[model samples]
Target: MKVGLKLNEQFTVSKHNIVQVTTFENEFHLALTNSEYLVISKDDKDNSYYYTHEFNGCLIEVPVNEYHRIQRELTEYFGVEIQDVSSDETKDQEQPEPTA
Candidate 1:
C-alpha cells in the first residue's frame, strides 16, 4: 500500500509494534525485527500524516495522499476498517478528577 508518512512521526497501531519512516536506518537499530515491518510509502511527506502509528527514528517522510491511498488498499486487502480519533470528541469526553 502507498501511504504518506514522515520522519520522527509517531503512531500507535496497537499496544506494541509501530511503523516508522526511515530512509538511512532500519528497524534493527531500534531493536525491532524486519519481519514486523509493514509497507513504506512513495512520498516521504505523506508518511507524516498517519493515524496513531508512530514512525520513530524515521529518516524519510511519506506524503499524506500516498499514505491514504495505501491505507485504503490495506483496509480492502485485509477487510478491516481503520478508525481515527477525533480531537472534538476527545475534548467533549474529558472528565474531571474527583476530589475528597
Candidate 2:
C-alpha cells in the first residue's frame, strides 16, 4: 500500500509506503520504502508541525504553515498507506500481481 501526497508548492509530490513508524521523545520517525524516511516534530508553543524528508542521503526540510490542515492530513494518512492513483498514468497502469 502507498499514500499519495502533494503538499502545496513542495515538489516532493509522490506516493510512499510506510514500513515502520517509531516515536522517540518529541519527534517521530517514519521509515518509508525506496530508501526514504521522514522525521516529524511538533511545536507546542504554536501548535504547528514541522518535518523533513530524506532520500538517498539527502534531506530536505518541508515547511508547512497550516497547522490544522497538515495535522488532519497526517492523522488521516498515518498508518494509512494505501494504493492511490496520483497521476493519470498510474490510473491506467496494470496491477503487478494477477489475481485468480
Candidate 3:
C-alpha cells in the first residue's frame, strides 16, 4: 500500500545530516549527500514498503510495486549496481519436467 507523505518531513541520514522532504505546488525538494545510500524495507503487515539509508530511519513508505520502481530509479540515479536476490531464487526453483 502507498504510504502518504507530507511536506516538511525530516528524515535522518547521518549522525549530523538529515534530509527534509518537501513539495511545493508542482515541485519537489529532496537533498542527498555525496555519499548517500538507499535502502528499501518491506513491512510485515500488508506488504507496505519504505526507502531509507542503511543506517537511518524510514524516509518514505511506498506501494509494493513502487518499491522496485524506486529501487531501479535510485540505482540509475546513483550509478550503482544492485544484485537481485529474488531472481536467483526463482532460477534455482525452476526444475526440469520429469519424463513420463
Error of 1 at 37 (Å): 4.6
- Give the local distance difference test score of model 2: 0.46
Top-down lDDT ranking: 2, 1, 3
lDDT of each: 0.39, 0.46, 0.38
Per-residue CA lDDT of model 3 for 1-100, tens digit only, reads: 2232222134333312324323322122344455443333332233222332433432443444554554454445445643344455566677666799
Candidate 1: C-alpha lDDT: 0.39
| Candidate 1 lDDT over residue span 3-23, tens digit each | 322222564233123333222
Per-model RMSD to reference: 12.0, 15.5, 11.5
Better of 2 and 3 by lDDT: 2
**TM-score of predicted model 1?**
0.32
Worst 10 residues of 2 by lDDT: 51-60
Q: Write the per-residue lDDT of candidate 2 for residues 29-56, one digit (tens) a residue.
A: 5566866666544444331333224233
Clashes of each: 35, 1, 0
Order of the predicted models by TM-score, top scorer first: 2, 3, 1
Q: Which candidate should be chosen as best, given TM-score against the real structure?
A: 2
